[model samples]
Target chain A: MKIFLHRRGFIARIAALMVLPFVAQRRAFAQSEAVDSLIEKITGGAPLQRGRVKLEIPTLADNGNSVSLRVVVDSPMTPSNHVKSIHLIAPKNPRPGVASFFYGAGAGRPQISTRIRLSGSQGVIAVAVSACWDAS
Target chain B: MAARISVPQNARRGDSIEIRVAIQHPMETGYRTDDNGTSIPKNVINKLACRYNGVEVFRAEMGSGISANPYLSFFIIAANSGELRFDWVDDAGVTGSERTSIIVAG
Candidate 1:
């Protein structure tokens, strides 16, 4: 912030620098919480806890057209303990639910990589569900 | 359809290796029309999946936002010698696949 202020001491620069964080903060919060609700809706309102899901994406992407992504879930992949499905959510995109990948014990490891389109810069969320946990 | 792939020929057990795949296609968007003034029906690869030794390891779903001649890069943990297969389906209901093999050293 100091560097930004020092580089551009103009009034517009000052205003922009100040407004940027607020805007980013609001958007970030809305986008993330929206993604959380989307996951909950997909899972039928099950308890949504965050852990064991890894989503890899570029921090800054100029072109929202085609962005590469990778997601991995830490699971044992055994019948008694395994990941049944992994879903991706991009809250701000035209389609919130970008992709859904199904897996079973045969999948060995629950991981996937693919390309996605983002209308603008926003964070992505991935949720992996456990069959054992769901079965009770 | 022509597809090209690049994967590690051999890797030490538990090594995370890179895999790249590129497919050739027009990927026409419905928004564009031909010289005849008829809208060029959209035909894009909507789904792509990667399977290792008959087990699905990766999957992706693309939309019209994707560029033509789609190329994707992914990773996998090499546990043993097996075949890595890729299958894709376009909106036009066309399906294609490509296969490659990798050997892991224990």
Candidate 2:
């Protein structure tokens, strides 16, 4: 009886130790998925490139409440290949989709500078769609 | 609800426009604990859209990764005189919008 009890206690401890990290990892994975969903939704299933949009943010933000941000897209401000719009999105904020901007071909430049609040250190995304001059 | 956005009343054509917007809300993410250790319910803005003279130019969907009092900046080509509109929506079904007009130079 004594031996059985000892073995049972040992097994229980080992099982718990094995399960803890998995639980923690699962939580982290869930958070990642939540953010991914936000991005997918914003793109409306469109493909996004890593270097296409330039997102300028501080490496470490002093205040999570307000941080400065600038997003610039590589596009000519011409009627043929201008940027139609720009969007800034954060998946973990109280509001996931932060802001959107619409521009026309007549708008000469394609750059924006603004400040944003971040709940924490989270990924920021900028989406730009090229103007369809033929349609216009 | 209405969103508060501020931009220069006058901007020259072909000049880069600066836009400042301040959204009023708690921006609760539901993951944090209060002083009492209770979980806070998630409340976040999920969608944002902007328009120039009624044409859809830019759109974004957001999550809880943003902080309170969210601010955004972007540019628009100043070709013709028209209104710039900003709109955003949260996860809990709250929506807000603000608008400003720009006088373009000939």
Candidate 3:
């Protein structure tokens, strides 16, 4: 009886150990999809290059009700070279699309500041499209 | 609802000037319930647009993820002296508009 009990315990532990990574990986993938797919949809599956957008938010927000947000993109703001639009995404929010800003050549600088709400602790992503990229 | 807009009184031509706007709103998320346990309907500003001298300069699409009393600050070039008009509409189909003028020096 004792041997049978010990063997059952060992089997259960082994099973748990084997399944842990898979479960964790699935959870991570789901979270990534929530954010990545939303971004992809906004960009229309366009390839994204890094280093143009700069998003500023409190590292540790005191309240999720209203958090200040600022986004800056590198652009000269001329008729030919300017930022087309900026999209703000909060993955953990019930709706990921926080806000989207469209700009014209008259926009002197590619920067904006606003307030947003968050459902929980998560990273905020800002994507900026340049006017020189495409017609649409 | 009332909206407040601020623009520089004067700016040199070709100079960049800051513009700030704030609106009075609840921006209800519809996720909360009252004492009766009845959920509140979501109502937030869905779109805002700014026009400079009848030319569209900036626009924003907002969702429930924005906080109550939405406020935004941005920059625009003082190409000409004219009016800056802001128009916005909320989920409840209510529209609000405000205007401010800036003087650009030559």
Which candidate leads the pack in lDDT? 3
Number of the top TM-score candidate: 3
- By TM-score, the candidates rank as 3, 1, 2
Residue-level lDDT tens digits of model 1 in B31-58? 6667778777778888988898988877
Q: Which ten residues in a row have the lowest lDDT in candidate 1 chain A?
A: A12-21
lDDT of 3 by residue, A20-95 (tens): 1112222222336777676666656555655567777767666677788788787766676678788887766788
Task: Residues A49-129, candidate 2: write the lDDT tens digits.
Answer: 444567777767666555677776776566666676666666545565666655644453567766665555566666666
> What are the per-model C-alpha RMSD values against the true structure?
9.9, 13.6, 12.7
Estimate, for each residue in B71-102, the C-alpha lDDT of model 2 and write its tens digit: 55555556567898888888789888888888
Docking class of 1: acceptable
Instruction: Give the per-residue lDDT of model 3 (tens digit) for B14-82.
Output: 888889989999988877767888887889999999999999889999998888999999988899998
Model 3 misplaced regions, further than 4 Å: A1-31, A133-136
| Model 3 DockQ vs. reference | 0.42
Q: Which DockQ value does candidate 2 get?
A: 0.33
Model 1 quality (TM-score): 0.64
Interface RMSD of 1: 8.5
iRMS per model, in Å, is 8.5, 11.1, 10.9
Report residue A125 deviation for candidate 2 (angstroms): 6.9
